[model samples]
Target: MSWVLGLSGLYHDSAAVLLHDGRVVAAASEERFSRVKHDAGLPVQATRWCLAHAGITMADVTHVTWYEKPLRKFERMLVSQVANFPRSASAFRRGTFNWLTEKLWVKAAIVKELGVAPARVLFSDHHQSHAASAFYASPYAEAAVLTVDGVGEWATTSLYRGGPGGLELLGEVLFPDSIGLVYSAFTAYLGFQVNDGEYKVMGMAAYGEPRFVDEVRKVLRPREDGAFDVDLSYVSYHWSADQSYTRRLEELLGPARFPGSGFDPTTAEGKRYADIAASVQRVTEDALVAIANVLHARTGLDTLCLAGGVALNSVANRALLTRGPFARLFVQPAAGDAGGAMGAALWTWHEVMGNPRTLDTPVLPGPGLGQAWDDATIGALLTDLRVKHEVLAPDTVAVRAAADIVEGRVLGWVQGRFEWGPRALGHRSILADPRRADMKDRINARIKYRELFRPFAPSVCAGAEGRYFDVPPGGEQLAEWMLLVAPVTTDDFPATTHADGTARLHVVHAAANPLYHALLTEVGRLTGHPVVLNTSFNLKGEPIVSSPVQALATFFRSGLDVLYLGAHRVEQTGSYDG
Candidate 1:
């Protein structure tokens, strides 16, 4: 059996995945263990965790693969900097220094970090990694693959055809013409962090009309063949690292929103910003739909696999499924740079190593591929911490937790393995009553401490999805990974429903997560609905908790009313009313 270790980081969302005999054993992001939000390091901690989880050492690994080619990325940076020359002097200086000092020698860095041989390390193209992550993990014999993201080497977007053999690159759109960057630029214009706040912009879009759609179109133009281009004069990302948009953008779209400023939807300026966000969201969805349609027409394949940062936009994903020609869609849960690790490993095993595809082994083993602690370990930790807690019977924990939710109490629920992706798929999640209108605000302000407009998602029983959500016929899988948004059938669950009456839904299957499924079933028995508000279990600007220690710390620090760690339960004792 061959073991492949894959790493993606140094840019953003650093992560590691261990593939044993072409099947994933463990995967996790560095940020989760490092306690940093989007840690951009070598992911040493994550690497160690993956190896330990697989009971293997670095020396036992057959190969180590990186998500992208550093030299190629440096070449792209040099070309961009040289083209802009004097205008990019400062940015170029920083980029060159970083690359020369660290980034360019990624293979050596990985070797040094892993203590592995130089020849053991390999590299894959950025978009190819994304494509491989999606297509290889999908349950398809053949499919059309689409990957879109902020500049990777030179390609920002790429299309591929994948089957039992391997993936073939079909076409690509180079940098400075990216839908991801365009959306991120708008995210910055709306006074939010560029890479971190795109989701916030998607949430804010639901509150307003697309009044500035024409203005945004001037910045991003879509063609009949599903290809698109950006007006570079308005974009400053190519030359300037500090600013994504130039003065020309401000002149066309009015003044940009101030970062960290308070936003009230009732105010005119706030409403204007929402309108701009709505315009960007609409244009982005349209462009993605156009691209999907073109890929479907070109490949003549009914199934589509999407990956990269742009694929994280659940709203745009739903639009593609409903409006595009593809009959089925599959999106890897961690469709961002973190997923590139898995892709690189798969690419090395099947494509570069000339190994045949194994149809029987599933590419992805659900999202719980991270660390897990058994009941004995959790109980020992609780005792060590001297925290007030109770051990309940296995069958009663879910019912008790569901009762807390029905009584309008916020809970931190941690069980089994940690999730391998961005979304908290029951393993590490905060649970709350979805029927309360103010539940969203309460959790946002007291627990998450995030923006007011940011929305919460819902996790419902699999078969009961259509009873509350307008999920399309083939959308069940997408919903299972929380990759699609659908309109709410009724306004009963206001907290989970966004302003547009849509919710990013997760359809939970009992076979995949029996405990979470039982909890939802109990919720249904009490409230006549099988859905609950679910979000990541961590404070703002922190990664999701991966251990019982981190879970307890967050529970006490935040306004969570209760915490369920395995079969043990801990309730807040003080008068900390939220």
Candidate 2:
């Protein structure tokens, strides 16, 4: 049996994935193990876990693949910094420091981490890794692929054609023009952290009008061939050390909003931020649509597979599904840097090893590939924490949790395994009754302690999805992963629906996750509605709670009413301020 280890790191969201034969066996992020949000180190713990999970030592792996090439990235950094000169000094210093320490010598580092010989280590281009992860894991046998993100070595966006065998690069949009960076610059200007808070900006956009759509269009000039260029004069990210948007950008937008600055969404300042967000989101849609159209025009492939961090934009994904050229879409659940692990492994499997690819059958592996704890582990944690808890029978955990949720109690549902991506899915999640209009406000203000505008996703059993939302025309293709947004027609579940009448839906199947599905089934039985408000099980500025200990701590600290850990149940007796 051939075992290949894939790793993506030395950048944000460092992660590792192990493939046995051709199937994904294990995958995890460094943040969960390191307790650092978006840890960008060598993913030592994650690598160790993958090895341990497969019951093999590092030396047992036939090959090790890194997510991206190092020298090429260093070249981009050096050239971009030198071209920008004095303005790039700050970013240069940061990049050089990182390169000197960790970013460079990736092959050496991987060997050291694995205790393997140097010859076993290999690397793929960042975009190639992203492309491989999407196409290899997707259900499509032959599909057009797209990967877009902030600069990776040099390329920022790439398109590919992939079949059962492997992928070929069709086109690419390189450095100095990137939608991801452009959006990130605005994310910074909107007084939010980059990389992490772009989703928040996506959510905030729904609140504002596209008043600045034309003004922002001056920056994102589209090309007839689906390539776009940014007005460099307005973007300082190419030059500025830390700041991404230049003074010219602030001038164009009128003024830069300070971080933590208060403004109502209905007010003028709020409206301005909203309008800018709307314009940028619209531009992003335009670019993605154009790219998809081009991919279709060239490949004539009805199926599309996408990865890279920008593919995490559900809004653009929806636009591609509805208005763009693709008939079917498959976005790897963990489409960001975390997914590079899968890509690196696949690149080695298909490209280097000369192994032919096979189409994944209808049964797509839902991303529940992280670590899981049994009842014994949960019991030990409860004993150590000295928390009050009861050990219910395995068959009754979901039913009990569903009853509590039906009673309007927010439940921290920690079961089976942790999800492999940014989304919680069924494994690591806080669940509430979607029918309660007050549920959204309560969770955001009390349990999540996040912004009021942040929207929560709805977890509907596949059978119940059609009752509430208009599934994409292709029907039940992309819903399983919660990668697409669909309009919810039913007003009964207002709490789960966003301002735009759309809900980021996770269509759960009983076969994929029995307990979570049973819980939703029970909830439907009680309330006559089969939807639950689902969000990542974590507080703001924290990675998704990984271990049972973290989940318990999060539960005690937040206003969550109860936590169901497999056969265990721990209810929060503390009063919530909200």
Candidate 3:
């Protein structure tokens, strides 16, 4: 049996994936184990966990694959620093220090970390990893693949054709002309963290009109050939990591929003920022649509597989589904750097190892591929902690949880394995009543402790998705992964719907997650709505809870009225805030 360990790190969202005999055995992000949001170091703990989960040691592994080529990336960094010269001195110094210390010696580091021979280690290009993660994981036999993200090695945006043998790089839009960086620069200008705050900007966009689209176009010039360029004069990220935008951007628009300042949409400045957010989001969707159209024209394929940081933009994804030429789409759940781990492993198994592709090899069981605790272990922990709880069967647990949700009680739902990606697809999620308008605010203030503007996603029964969402003709695949933003048809579930009447909806099929589907079915029977407001089961700035212990801790720390852990129903007797 061949065992391949895939790793992605030294940037953000480090992760590890284990492929046993060309099948994905386990995969997890470092943040889950490190408890750091977007941990950038090598995923030591995650690697060990994956090895343990696979019941193997590093010595048993036949090959180790890294997501990206470190030397190639370092070369690109050196060239960019030289191109920018004196202005990039500080960034150059920092880059040089990082590379000399760690990044340049990635192969050596992997060898040392895993205690494996140097010959066993392999490296894949950054875009290749992203493309592999999308196309190989997708159900499609042959499809067009697109990967767009901030600079990786040198390429920022890439197009690929995936078929029996492997993926072929069709074309690419190189660094300094990246849509991902352009969006990130605007994300920074909108008073949010660059990598972390892009979603917040997407959420905030719903509140205003795209009044700044013309100005945003000046920053990102889109061409008819599905390629785009960023106006370097307005962007400073290439020269300095400290800031994404320069003074020219402020002059083009208005004063940049100050970081950490609360968003007040009623105020003129707040309204202006919202408009800018809307404009950027619109421009991003336009560029994505253009790119998708080009890929479709070239490949003439019905299905498209998308990966990379830009692929996480559900709004743009939905726009592409409805308006672009592709009839169907599949986006890797962890479509960011974290997913590169899985991509590296698959690329090695199929492309490098000369293994033939199978029809069933690409499909995942579900997103809930992380660790899970059995009832006995959970019960023992609850007893040890003196937590008041009752054990119920799976069906009863679903029924009670549905009742609690319908009664407007927020619940911490932890069942089965935790989800592998950034989304909470039933397991490790906070569920609440979606019908109440005030529910969103309550969860934001009492549980999440996040910005009120950030919208929550809805977990709906797969068959019932069309009842509430204006799902496009070919949105089934996108909805299954919660990768599509669809318009809400009714105001019944106000909490889940965003200000723009759209929602990032997760369609839960019984075959994929029986317990979650049962709960949604019960919820439908109780309230005529098969949807529940769902968000990741974690507080602000923290990774999602992975273990029963973390789930219990978060349960007592937050304002959750009920805690569902496997077959146990935990109820806090008194008000105890951690």
Candidate 4:
């Protein structure tokens, strides 16, 4: 059997995936194994895990696919920096060092790291991989594909058509104008880290009004053609080397907020920032709608596939599904750079190796490709640690956890295999009653301990989704893997709905995961509501809690009421008496 290894590395969210005979055997991100938040390096630990999980050695890997062609990226960098002249000098130096030292030699580096010959290595364009990951892993036969992210060589945005026949790139928006960069620029201007903090901006946007929507429109204007340009005069990314935010952004939005400075959401400045965020979010949605319309008109395809960091915006995703022209949609669970690893492998299988695509309904079974521990294994660990625990029969664990949640008890639920991407799904989740308005604040203060304004997602039963959400599960568009957001029906589940009446909902089906489905069913029976507030089972500034020890630590450190690990249950006796 032939085997292929795909890699996306030397950047934030580095990852590796192994495909044996065109089937995905294993996939993981460097952050999970390295214990670093968004570690940007060769995924050595992750690669080793994937190989070991597949019961193979590096020698068995017949092909190695690099996520992006570096030489083309170098060309784009040279031209863009030259266009900016001396203003881009510092960025040019940093880019040159990074590329010359490591990125440009990605193929050789992969060979050296894997102890394989360089001849086995192949490469694909950055956006091609993104597009492949979206379409190949989706359950659609014929679909319009869109990939958007920060500069990918020269192309920031690309549209494609894919199906059993083949995949083809239809249109592209080149660099110097990117929605992702514009969002990142504002992310930095708001005193948050760039790649890591964009979501925070998304979360924070809910608190602000879109009053500045008109002002933002002055700089970011959409074109009649699906492609649009950012007014460079209102931005300065081309000139800066050390920072992501431009001076123009500060001038437009007022002085940058100090990174740690406290700003009450009720204040004028905070409202202004919120308005800007809402405005940007609106513009992004408009661009996506415009692009989707163009792709639909060109391809006449009813289904669409989305990838890239921007695709992670569940709000925008919901808009694309309901408001846009597409009748169906699919998004990769790990749509960020980490997903590039999966994209590279799939691209190799379908594009370079010339394998035909399939219209399989279950493109991805679930995002649970990382790790799993049975009750026996968990029992052994609990015994070794001398931790207090109760081992319930498999039939009763889900029911018990559901009852606890309905009773307003916070629970650390770790079941089955871990999820593949950033989201915890049902496997590694901290759950609570969504009907309780206080649940959000309590989670933010006790468990998440992050920004209070940030909202929590709801994990709901697939069957009951129609009652709670205004939008039906996309037929093939079900977010079995928590990739899409939809409007919550105000009459059904008001607590989970955001200020805009939207809920980032996960539609869980029984076939994909029986245990999680059973738990949600029990929760529905108890509370008369199928929804529960779900977040990753980890403390602030850490990867999703992986091990039993981590779950326990977070349970104790945070104010969680109980932890349901596999068939075992650990409940908090009382608050930390210290």
Arranged by lDDT with the best first, the candidates are 1, 3, 2, 4
Each model's total of backbone clashes:
0, 1, 0, 1
Local distance difference test values of all predictions, in order? 0.91, 0.86, 0.90, 0.81
Task: Report the CA-based lDDT of candidate 4 relative to the real structure.
Answer: 0.81
User: What residue pairs are clashing in model 2?
Assistant: 91-241
TM-score of each: 0.98, 0.97, 0.98, 0.95
* Displacement of the residue 529 alpha carbon in candidate 1, Å: 0.8
The model with the greatest lDDT is: 1
Tens digits of per-residue lDDT for model 2, 1-578: 98998998888999999988877888899898888999988899999988888899987898999899899989988998999888788888887998998777787777776697899999899999999998888767799999999889899999999986579889999998998999898999998889898997898888877778777777878898888999998888887657888888888888877887764688988988988888889989999999899999999999889898988888788888899988888888789999998899988988999887665442226678888888998888787767778889888888898889888999888887688889999899999988899999899999998888889999998788888888886536567878788888889987888988898889999998988989889988888887899999999889998888888878888999888887888878832223
State the lDDT of candidate 1 residue by residue for 358-465, as single tens digits: 778687888899999999999888777777788999999999999999999999999999998899999999999999999999999998898888899999998898
Write down the worst ten-residue block by lDDT for model 4: 471-480
Q: Give the range where candidate 1 is weakest over 10 consecutive residues by summed lDDT.
A: 569-578
The model with the greater lDDT, 2 or 3, is 3
Model 1's TM-score against the true structure: 0.98
**lDDT score of residue 357 within candidate 3:** 72
Candidate 3, residues 13-76, lDDT tens digits: the string is 9999988877778889999988899999998899998999888899899888999989888888
Assess candidate 1 and give its lDDT. 0.91
Top-down TM-score ranking: 1, 3, 2, 4
Stretches off by above 4 angstroms in model 3 are 575-578
